[model samples]
Target: MMKVMVMVKATAGSEAGVMPTNELMEAMGSFNEELVKAGIMESGDGLKPSNEGYRVRFSGSKRSVIQGPFVETNELVAGYWVWNVSSMEEALEWVKKCPNPMFEDSDIEIRPFYSMEDFADVDTSGEFRAQEDALRHTLSLQKASLNNYLFFSGRCEEALNYYVQHVGAKIDLLMRFSDSPEPIPEDMLAAGFEDKVMHCEFTLGGAKVFASDGCNDGTTLSGFSLALTVATAQDAQRVFAALSENGQVTMPLAETFWSPLYGQVTDQFGMAWMVMLPAT
Candidate 1:
């Protein structure tokens, strides 16, 4: 419920460009991973040596600039993390578990961030709080999103099940022609296609995609292929096999100039997919 900034103080050795050893780096990576898995880590980063930085000082109507290699080495921050913890005690406990961040002895300081509630006495009109809320809303709106929609001639239900079984897609929503409050035109569906899927949403590879059985006009998916990127060659081969079964493989899975494993396949439902491991 409380946000805290944890700062790693720069050490003489760190300021002298002494880098962390592989073992220490691994330990820090593991520690950060643990923090993320616990959902307390908001953001963190290590800073470059202060010698490469600058400072700006301002007076009533004057400004002065100072280049760094700032003499007070101990006062410089080497890195910092913004974490949300239940209490200062929790933050202290987590900090105690962190590895020494520098080659030499170093200090880590934890300070709580000022919450909106702390300003209640100053902002009697609630103006600052309203502005903060509006900025937060704008930040949320700036998050981008994209979704893919697929149409099947009349096999959407079967295709959804096929995807769920083969590629682990999770169907979040589904509606049939009969589920519509307004009657579906007779010509819109072939004889037994009335029970087919009208619309459904599913997630594959962490992306939401839409699927539906459109009017039986014989149209099929074309022009675009869903790109399924996996982590390793083994996964790429396995998914390619599952998707290409009974379908044609435009490009057999093999080592490519771009990827370690790559291929193209048109699934049995006539949907094309590009299966590959991400290029290093």
Candidate 2:
């Protein structure tokens, strides 16, 4: 796989100055040692001050020299590292543990380098192609991540079935309230809940939804809604009616130019649902 390059941009927070203190330098050295031992990092180093740098320019045989200490310090890259990893995702996993380079907030940009074979003809066949294909697949899977937000209230497990039936979302994982390894204290367990859904995940189309419930203190969903689009008016109406049976309808299902059927409702737990079906 190609190498991953992590570029760090430094900035001066206060007008006082942009200089690394001795303590900060020591911290960076320790952090770099950790990275080296992890085996993911190949090499890294700090840059010389802009004042010690020079730029060479060529204007059609009229070579010119632009000296150091450019006024535009904000545009400069402070430091960088080259990491040998199988994929960008692997590189990101390593980056998450990277030591904070700045005493204040700074931006880090991660990019993958292209190998020479990426430009080669399709007829090329070798271990290089295999590695490239694997990297591409890994990146594709990372891009497909849903990054869904999870919510829950009492009886979330029961609610999950309703959503799955109407939305065609299958539960990928579930942790029921009763499945906790440690026994919940009697007072806490019997506070006010009958049953809770510890955690549950559902996938509809290419998206994911996660939820849980059954805490002693009741939870309620507010100011949020899930929007769903179906393929046909019949499907939409069927799904909406099912969801509405145990919930309250805010907008009656009806035909519209945008979709053959559309409606909104708040399920029994206070979670809002919106349904849309393609126009016939």
Best by lDDT: 1
Tens-place lDDT digits, model 1, residues 1-280: 9999999999898788788899999999999999999989989999988998999999988999999888898889999999999999999999999998987788999999998899999999999998987576445434423345677878788778999999999999998888876777667677777788876889999888867786564555524457666755555666788888999999899876556787979999998877776555
- Score candidate 2 by lDDT: 0.68
Name the regions of candidate 2 deviating beyond 4 angstroms: 13-23, 121-280
Could you tell me which residue pairs clash in candidate 1?
none
Candidate 2 — which pairs collide?
196-214
Q: Per-model C-alpha lDDT, please? A: 0.82, 0.68
Tell me the spans in candidate 1 whose CA falls farther than 4 Å from its real position: 148-280
Model 2, span 1-280: residue lDDT tens: 6588898765663212466779878877777787777666777866766667788998898988888766665676678999888788888876777677777877778988877466567536566776766576455434332234345556566667877888777889886656666566666654555456665768888777756563544446513357666655555666677788879998888865445777878778787776776444
lDDT of 1: 0.82
Error of 1 at 76 (Å): 0.9
Give the count of colliding residue pairs in each prediction.
0, 1
In order, what is each prediction's RMSD in angstroms?
Answer: 15.7, 20.2
Q: TM-score of model 1 relative to the true fold?
A: 0.59
